[model samples]
Target: MSTLTERIDIQVKSRHELDEQLEAAVRELQEAALHVRARGILITRRLPGRYTAELSDHVPFGMTRELLR
Candidate 1:
């Protein structure tokens, strides 16, 4: 009976430790996800401006060609 009780206690402690580690891992994953989402948002916000700049740079060339013709 004593040995059974001792085994049960050890199992409980191990399970508790595993639960804590799992919680910590979940928190870390959430933080990483937030950082990734923020970076994605930043990139998305900049895309339109970058595309407009590229288009604007080509406009002068087109205008110059029209003038030459």
Candidate 2:
């Protein structure tokens, strides 16, 4: 399976703009045609609820967090 983690912040004046942005994003992803070792997809969205920079570490299954340090 493949996992996609995305965080998008919006401060748009109209709903139509949001819809258009979403459509463009979807099309971009589809055009990329990403390669995956597994057959399924998993997506996670994290909205921090406040304006702040975020960080992420992509560690796959069977890996320990400490190993990264």
Candidate 3:
């Protein structure tokens, strides 16, 4: 029970940090007033401690894609 509580706390903290970072990105882009969803980042683990991130057209604009995950 204690372990689960600790894990939840850690996840909560991490999520908050990620939210802040995303907010900063949106603010820096200067598109705060407008909502645009067309592209996304797909990160995949390549090697140990290394990963590859690519700009994917997964964000539904007028089409859809199969979610494998």
CA deviation > 4 Å runs, candidate 1: 1-13, 38-69
TM-score of each: 0.33, 0.35, 0.30
Predicted structure with the largest lDDT when compared to the true one: 3
lDDT per residue (tens digit) for residues 1-69 in model 2? 755423334334466765565455444333332333222211222332212111123433222121110
What is the overall TM-score of model 1 with all chains considered together? Answer: 0.33
Which runs in model 2 stand beyond 4 Å of their true positions? 1-11, 37-69
User: Taking the tens digit of each residue's C-alpha lDDT, what string does model 1 give over 13-41?
Assistant: 35566456434533443444343332110
Model 2, position 54, has a per-residue lDDT of 15
Give candidates' CA RMSD values in order.
Answer: 27.0, 10.6, 14.2
Look at candidate 2 and give me any clashing residue pairs. Answer: none
Deviation from native of the Cα of residue 16 in model 2, angstroms:
0.5
Name the lDDT of candidate 1.
0.25
Report the lDDT of model 3 for residue 13. 31
Error of 2 at 18 (Å): 0.6
lDDT of 3: 0.34
Candidate ranking (TM-score, best to worst): 2, 1, 3
Per-candidate clashes come to: 0, 0, 0
